[model samples]
Target: MVFAPGEKPGSESEEAKLQIASKQIVQNAILRAVQQVSRESRQREAGAGDTPRGSFRPGAGELTKKHEKK
Candidate 1:
């Protein structure tokens, strides 16, 4: 859609191609967003499930068998 000063307009086919390219760019962005949201949802579900998932609350904490006396 960018035109230089004193530049002639593009042909119908050129405009059509530009429109198609723009559409593909928008569609790709939408698809990536959808995938990200879905992945986050799965992580949240895993965090809430019985099995430990993320670092927020990873399994039961272990105690060190060796103790140091100050």
Candidate 2:
């Protein structure tokens, strides 16, 4: 629904207040989801530096070594 400039919802009638509140609730939910996604993306990017890429070598005496016959 479109509104005139400087006009507010729920101003016309008592019933319109319910509709206005519902619209506000939906808009707030969408805004929160967008912000959460943006925050997580930034965190992942920042944490990438803690672990180097392609550097996952197993310990010398780990499972692979134990399984080998003497």
Candidate 3:
């Protein structure tokens, strides 16, 4: 997506292309930000001195206890 002050205005097709390009750029930036945040969270967890108390894992399937009746 090229934006120039002196250049001729874009045609309809050119404008659509520019819009798509801009959307993709925004989506990519958001994706990168999310990834960075996730990475930082993992780093913080690793550096913390205290051990996690629970056996539960985020996004992992639920574990059924043997004593529980189905």
User: Using lDDT as the measure, which candidate wins?
Assistant: 2
Q: Each model's TM-score, in the order given?
A: 0.52, 0.56, 0.52
Over 28-67, each residue of candidate 2 has an lDDT whose tens digit, in order, gives 9999999999999999899877768876757834667658
RMSD of each: 9.0, 10.5, 8.1
Clashes of each: 0, 0, 0
Q: Order the candidates by lDDT, highest first.
A: 2, 3, 1
Q: lDDT of each structure?
A: 0.76, 0.81, 0.78
Candidate 2 segments whose C-alpha is farther than 4 A from its true place: 1-11, 57-70
In model 1, what is the error at residue 22, expressed in angstroms?
0.5
Error of 1 at 7 (Å): 15
Top TM-score model: 2
Candidate 3, position 62, lDDT: 54
lDDT of 1 by residue, 3-27 (tens): 6566567644666779999999999
- Over 1-70, each residue of candidate 3 has an lDDT whose tens digit, in order, gives 8756655556456668899999999999999999999999998888663646665557556566864568
Lowest summed lDDT over 10 consecutive residues: which window, candidate 3?
A: 3-12
Angstrom error at residue 53, model 3: 12
